[model samples]
Target: MFGDIMGMMGKLKETQKKVQETKERLNTVLIDEQSSDGLLKVTLTANREIKSIHIDDSLLQDKEQLEDYLVLTLNKAIEKATNVNETELAAVAKEGMPNIPGMDAFMK
Candidate 1:
């Protein structure tokens, strides 16, 4: 029983290291989103860090429109990034997790 516990501890440590590495890798994964008319565009990492924003010249003329576009576009970009981040991290975690009884349901 002690041997089993020790092996599980070692596996958990390895999993922790892999999770950190996966998070770092996610920083390089980019997610792009644009307005329906393509007037506004955004880029963000899977880490949800804003990388860039591109606005059309027409959007500059109307502050309210610009704000609306920014809100909508950025929200979409963030949503996509969050999905990617969660999915990737979950996959890494699930893959590395030790097969503990009753933990499978929680992981899902």
Candidate 2:
């Protein structure tokens, strides 16, 4: 019985370490999306921090069109980053969830 308890504790510690590592790595992961015409581009981290933007110089003369392209590009980048975030969270879940007395039944 004591050995079984120790084994479970070891598994729990390993899972916690993996979860922490995944979260740290997520901040460094980059996800990018561009407008359909490729005039605008946006890059963000997997954790949704906007890192950079690129816009064609030709669009700068027209404020309205520039705004439209910016919006479209940003939204696409956000969507992509969100999908990446979900995937990362799921990977962490597959690693193992926080240990609780009775949560395993519900999590599975």
Candidate 3:
């Protein structure tokens, strides 16, 4: 019983290390998303911080349309960043704890 407990503790430490490494890597990754017409684009880090935005000059002619496109593009960028973060985190969790049910949820 004591040996099993020690093994589990070691596994937990490894999982914690993996999660920290994943979070650090995510901070450096970026995702880009664009509007349907490609008139607007947004770039966000994996941690959901907006890095930059691009807008076509033609879209500036109409303020309302430009605003709408900006919103849409930003949302798309956030969604993409979230998806990438989740995928990477999930991979790390799976590698560290393959049989632990709801390990991902527990991490959060």
Runs off by more than 4 Å, candidate 2 = 1-13, 98-108
> Against the hidden reference, what TM-scores do the models get?
0.93, 0.72, 0.79
Ordered by TM-score, highest first, the candidates read 1, 3, 2
Per-candidate alpha-carbon RMSD to the true structure: 1.2, 3.7, 3.5
TM-score of 2: 0.72
Lowest lDDT 10-mer window, candidate 3? 95-104
Q: Considering every candidate listed, which one attains the maximal TM-score? A: 1
Clashes of 3: 0
Instruction: Summarize candidate 3's per-residue lDDT along 1-108 as a digit string, tens digits.
Output: 999778878988898899899899888898988988888888889989888888999999999999889887888788888998998887776776646666667766
Query: Model 3, stretches more than 4 Å misplaced?
Result: 98-108
- What are the lDDT figures for the candidates, one per model? 0.93, 0.82, 0.85
lDDT of 1 by residue, 14-69 (tens): 98999999999999999999999998999999999999999999999999999999
Across 19-95, the per-residue lDDT of candidate 2 in tens digits comes to 77877898899988888888888889988899999998988999999999988888887888888888877767666
As a whole number from 0 to 100, the lDDT of residue 56 in candidate 3 is 92
lDDT value for model 2: 0.82
lDDT of 3 at 70: 85
> Higher lDDT: candidate 1 or 3?
1
Clashing pairs in 2: none
